[model samples]
Target: MDDFYSKQSPFNPDVKSFRFYKNGNLKIELKTKEDAEKVARLLLP
Candidate 1:
């Protein structure tokens, strides 16, 4: 997850932080709900 964040964050400054859980859940913190939704869409398969 750290590698993914490091590579992706440079292109997205709005992404403030991220957490990956053992239960296969990822939590991403962005500047706004809209931005979060956009990132989620981009990350989803």
Candidate 2:
């Protein structure tokens, strides 16, 4: 998990990323409609 966050450079300015919650919730600040679709797919049961 640390390695993944490191790869994303969380300290960098304005980096788009998704956060997977422990309760299967995905948290992200979507910047485009395409991003929303991608997340929706992953969340589908």
Give per-model TM-scores.
Answer: 0.46, 0.36
Q: Judged by lDDT against the true structure, how good is candidate 2? A: 0.54
Query: Which window of 10 residues has the lowest lDDT sum in candidate 2?
Result: 1-10
Candidate 1 — which residues are off by over 4 angstroms?
Answer: 1-11, 37-45
Best-fitting candidate, scored by lDDT: 1
Clashing pairs in 1: none
lDDT of 2 by residue, 1-45 (tens): 422222222343333665655555655656677766876898896
- Deviation in angstroms for 40 in model 1? 6.4
Model 2 pairs in collision: none
- Count of backbone clashes for each model? 0, 0
lDDT for residue 45 in candidate 1, whole number 0-100: 84
Encode model 1's per-residue lDDT on 1-45: one tens digit a residue.
Answer: 343423124336787767666566666678888987887799898
Clashes of 1: 0
